[model samples]
Structure formats: C-alpha cells, structure tokens
Target: MRLRALLTTAALLAASACGATPDAPAKTTLTWWDHYDSGAADQAVTALIARYQGAHPDVEVKRTAIPPAEFRAKLDQAAASGAFPDVVAVDSPDLPRLVAQNAVADLTDRFQGWAVGEALLEPVRESARHGGRFYGVPLRSETLALVYDREVLAGAAPPRTWDDLRATAKALTRDGRAGLCFAGLPEEDLTSTFLAFLWQAGGDLDTVDDEAGVEALAFVDELVNVDRSVPAAALGWDNAQVAREFAAGRCAMMVNGPRVVQVLNQAGMNWSVTALPSGAGGSASPLGGETWVIGKGSRHADAAWELLKSLAENRDNITEFGAGLGALPNRGDTVQDLAWQWDPNVAAFAAQMPEARPRNGYGTKYPQVSEAVWTMVQQVLKGDREPEEAAAEARAKIEPLLRER
Candidate 1:
C-alpha cells in the first residue's frame, strides 16, 4: 500500500474512540502528543498552544506529554488502534518511519504563505520533507557540543582540536572522573555521537566501509580502550545517562547539547559549554530537534495546519517557545542576537551551528540505520569485534535499509 493509504488505515484504527456524535461541538479539539516532559518544555508548549487557541477560539488543543522511553510504543499502539492524536511532535529522525507507515499528513498545501517557510533552517525543513511532500513544521532545534565542568577544568579551558580533546580527556581522566561521557548503548543516540566523529574524520555513514569509517570507529574505541578516557559503564549508557553523568560531575566532559546545559543548571552544577572538538577537517556536530506533524488521519486538516502555522510562523511565538525550552530558534535571525552570543553556554553551541550537519541521505530510516551503526560500535567497544569488522557489519546491516528508503 502507498504511504498515504497506510496512514489512513492507521488513522481509522486510532480514531474509533470518539464514536460519532452529531451533538459534538462545531469547533474541533485537536490532540497533540509530545515527549517533552520538563517544566521548561511544558511551559513553552503551553504558551504556543495558548497563542494558537487565542487566534482560533473554536479549536481546542489537548496536549499531553509521554515519557520518551514509552513514546514510540504508545504511538504504535495508537496507530494500530486507529486512535492517534490530531497532531504529534516527532524528532526529525523518526519522522520517516511515520511517513513510511503513511501515518502523517501531506503538508505541501499548508506550506505556502506560512511565515515559517521563510524562517525554518534548510536542513530541518529537508528532514521533514519526503518524496516531494512536507510532513512536519520545524519547531525547536539543538546541536551537539562539548560540555565540561569549570571546576574540573580549573584554569585550563576545554580543548579545541581533536588531538587536543584526546590529550585533555586523557589528562582529565583521573580519580573517579572520566574525560568523556558518551552514549554507547544500542540506540540512536550512540549512533548520533559516532556520526559526529565519522563526519569529522571526513567519512560518511552512508559509505561506512571506507578508511575514514574505520578510523572513526577506531577513534572511539581508542577512547574506550587505549586512552581509557571513557567509563566502562558507557557500554550500557543511553543518551540520558551520558547527560546525567556529566551533570553529576562523574565525567569531566561530554558530547551533548543545550538540553544538557539546562539539566546541569537545574541541578546547581557549575559548568560551561564549548564546540565539539575538531578533527583534521575542523568542528562538526549533528543537528537535533523536534518537528510538528499533522496526523494523516486528522479529520480537521485545515485547523491542524492553522495550528502548525501559528506555532512556527509567528516570530514572537517562536522566540518565546525557544527561550522557555532553552532551544535555539530554527531561524538564523532569531538566534544571531548579541544576547545569545554573550551567553558563554549558548555561544559555544551557536559556534558549531555553522558546521552542523543533518542526518545523511537516509533521512527517513535515520533511527533504524543509526541503531545498526551503534550495534557495530558496541561490539568494537566490548572487544567482541574489531573496528574493521564492526564497520563491515554496520554496512551490511544498513545497506538493505538504505535501499528500502
């Protein structure tokens, strides 16, 4: 079946709940589900919803936050049951899966004249587009950076070059603290961290069988094995654990983004942020963030589009949303102000924005392909597979998926 048809079927399965009632109010209530559970995220989303509601008093928005761990499963269950939300917030990488399953709306009609069209970052917009149709609205975005505790670094600053990073991490890996804390688990986060290195090494994950690929994989293994800068627990650590370890000062530095900065700040930890260490080619980081998508089955398509437009098109709304969530605005103009530049933490992350890369070619199967790469890395980290073997294994697993896309 075509993607749209698949989505229609999923939508029907999920919508069986409301049971037809002619007496229902003429104004539709759109349900929006997201994985943002923090106070800041909630407040940001709430403000956006309120703004949207004000513009169209007839439309009611029911927003709910699902735990990230269970989000995918719940979404799947909703799809199977034909009772999905009217709109959903999805990470760029996972958007493709929904698109493939035909669970999202074709947003091409909604893009024209939307102020968000002018403001959205290109890479973010591209991620939400598939087969010539746009599926989502770019919301808040984030990119990876090196986060370190000022007290641990003392007078010395965080490293700039890849070599400098390695040496600094080695030097800082004393006592119970690790020099680097990265997610090495069997998940997409681990793949994201690895991809930063691969790109830095002038390699591409799509071409994982090359020399740069081997070197990229080896470089991480070196940190885990020879350099001993990473903790053994990293093998089991997911993205959240890496951030937690850094916030607790168990790691001197970590590969993370602004969200981690917000977490550390909330915990009363003293820390600073810097661009990710540069490789031979210089600094690089992956673009990460959420996108707003209308469900393929949404009965109130035009109303959903209006909500999406209000959320992403209004500059003031975007600013308020980004500010509350500690997220950088998707538009360059909004983030180029002197205020953001002067803030050391925000400055470091902003510095890497110029070199930030979207997930390469397999935009849709990003999550699945990423997991395959992580599986390969995990084997190498555990000494169960050599770097070359791991790269080969990753390529073997990813090739078929890429073909499907």
Candidate 2:
C-alpha cells in the first residue's frame, strides 16, 4: 500500500510538471507502448515512465501497457498502418523481425555514448542487435532454472548433471508431488524450454541433422513417458501455471525463472534455485528479456531517444525495475552493484548469466521456427512419434523459415 501510494504520488508530480514551460522549447509528446503483463512488472514500468516524465518535463510520454498475448499482433497491425508508437518495449526475440521489416529504428548511434547500452551483458545486447547493428536497448532479462522446495530436497542436492537430474527427479516422485515439472504448452514458452535442451545437447538451430537434437528430445521423452516422473498435466501447462504448481507444492521441483521468487518469499515457502542441469554442452540456458526500441514511424524520434538515453544513464531505474519484476539485471555493471552481489539466488543466477544463449536464431522468421520446435515436443510428449522422427520433422518444418532473409 505504501509503495502504491508512492508511485501514485510520483505519477501526479510527473503529470503536474508536464505542462508547457515558457523558458523552454515546445514540449514533445512521445507515445510509448509496453507489454509488461504482470502486475508488479507493469507497475515498475509505469513508475519508470513517471520518473522519466518528472525529470524531463519538456517531454510528455503517453504510455500504454498491453496484454502480452495481444502485443505482437497489435504492434504489427500498428506498424502496417504506419501508426506505431514512438517508443516500445518489445520482446527480445521479436526485435530481429521488427528490424528486418523496418518497423523499429536502429539505435546504434544513440547507443554510442550511453553507458548502460555499452555495458549491457553480451547475450542481452545480442538479443537487440542484428547484422552488425543495434536496434534496441536492453530492458530486463530472465532464464529458466531449477526452482525447488528446499524442505523437499533437504538431503538431495539440486540436479547438477543429466544423470543426476533424471535420478533425483525419479527418486523424488512421491508424496503427492510430481517430482519435476515445467511448462511445455505451446508457442514461445515450450519452444524456449526446447532451445535450452537443444543447446545443452550441443545442438543449434542452424544444423538440422545434429544428433544432439534427438538426444535432447529423447531425454524429455524418458522423463514423461518412460519414467513417468513429470505429470502429464505439465504437457498442457504454461510458465505461470508451472510456477503456481511449484509454489502450491503440487511439484517438488520446477523449471522456471526468478520472477516467482518474490511470491515464494511471500508465501513463506522454503525455496531455492540453481542453474539448470548441465548436459554434454555444460551449463547453457535460453535467454528472455524486453528491449526498448523506437518505432519506424515515430515522428518524435529525438524525444524518444532522449527518453531512452535517460533510462540508460539511470542505473537505479534498471536495478529497481529488475528488483520489482524479480528479473535479472540486463547490464554487466548493474550486476556488480552491492544490492545484487549479496543475494545468494541472484548470485547463483549471475554465475550462469554469462553462458545464456538467445533462443531465437538471429533472423526474422523465428516465430515459425519456434512453432516447429514446440510442435515436435508436443508430438513426442503425446507418444505419437519417436524423438528421432519428431526432430527430423521439426527440422524439416523450420528449414524453409530459416532460409528466409
């Protein structure tokens, strides 16, 4: 309640200062669109906007928060209509396509002197860049990890290797808990998990015939069909559902991000997180984050850039935003801050951040490719196809998409 009151006060002050200043140049109104769907995350973003507005009274940012499911479709429609917002918080994976289609502006020049832009962790920066140019600024980042009930795994260590993971999960599968579970429902969520698995097996999207692809799928198949360790309900669950189940004690262990840590802390559940189990490729994870971009049709690009530059220069904004959302810091410098260095879970995740990999290939057709990957997982999970056959079919489906420029 106190925090909400503070935010409201901040917003009112920003709004009050937004009027024209006789001594300054004409005020510019910048339209900003964001898809921070969760309540706390959404609050953080709106507060950030208010802070920006308070500092730069000459620039009034009209912000809109969209539902995540509708964001892409709405943005695409707006882009086609030449009415895209001036500033946008875009999904990291979608930036490549937006840049390719000229829906977003290239930020290379604006990012040059910006310390935050320059100090962004490599994987976070890579998510916003393509073909030697930066198209967006890193917002926040997240990755899948082992979130476990500390009480449940009192004696057993969090899984370290594939063998350990499988054995531990099977051993823990009792007492009304599924042992191990994760989201594998559809589209991005399922595909993101698959990317982590694929990379762990030492395979990447470019190679269709890589044996590792089948190996990874086979492992997941064993967990579901053979070992019966993960509940069949997980096959239809999404990330939120997976987190809730873990928090509710429906599962002893879950593969999810740190965003749920705050809820776990509130619920007073004895929980801890560790790096995802290492495989043949060692520790590797799929990356996810939001990127701030200037839309192609933005008339107030200068004002938009100013807003972005302010956000980059303000490290506190980044840190506070990440803390509010339970997301990882997107910049290397921020990771070194004393606020994060002492937190055990954040420190553990920081150790793995360097090894994180972008889930989407650096291309415009990633959505199609990801759909293919998830489809294969669904087919294999249903026992409708062998891992080898499913992987081959998946690769075949995505080959054409990858070949697109």
Best by lDDT: 2
Count of backbone collisions in candidate 2: 0
Per-prediction CA RMSD (Å): 10.7, 9.2
lDDT for each residue of candidate 1 in 1-405, tens digit (9 for 90 to 100)? 699999998887667655743465577889999987767777778888888888888999999999888998887787777777899988777777777777888888778766657566676667677776788887767888888888989979789887898899999998889998888888878888988998888888768979989988889989999999998899899777898988887999998877665678777888888888878656688988777888888898888887877776666664455557667655666557554432457766766665577663475566678788888889899999999988998898888888866
lDDT of 2: 0.81
| 1-405 per-residue lDDT for model 2 (tens digits) | 999999999987887799734466788999989887667887888788889889888888888888988999998888778788999988788887877777898788877877767787888888878877888877668778888898999967789988988998998899678889988797788888877878888887766447888888998999988888899999889888888888888888888887877767777788888999988977788888778899877888888888887776776685556667666866777665666542457766766776788754547888888888889899999998898888888878788887873
Off by over 4 Å in 2: 1-25, 341-344
The lDDT of model 1 is 0.80
Model 1's TM-score against the true structure: 0.86
Q: TM-score of every model?
A: 0.86, 0.91
Runs in model 1 with CA error above 4 Å? 1-25, 80-83, 315-320, 338-344
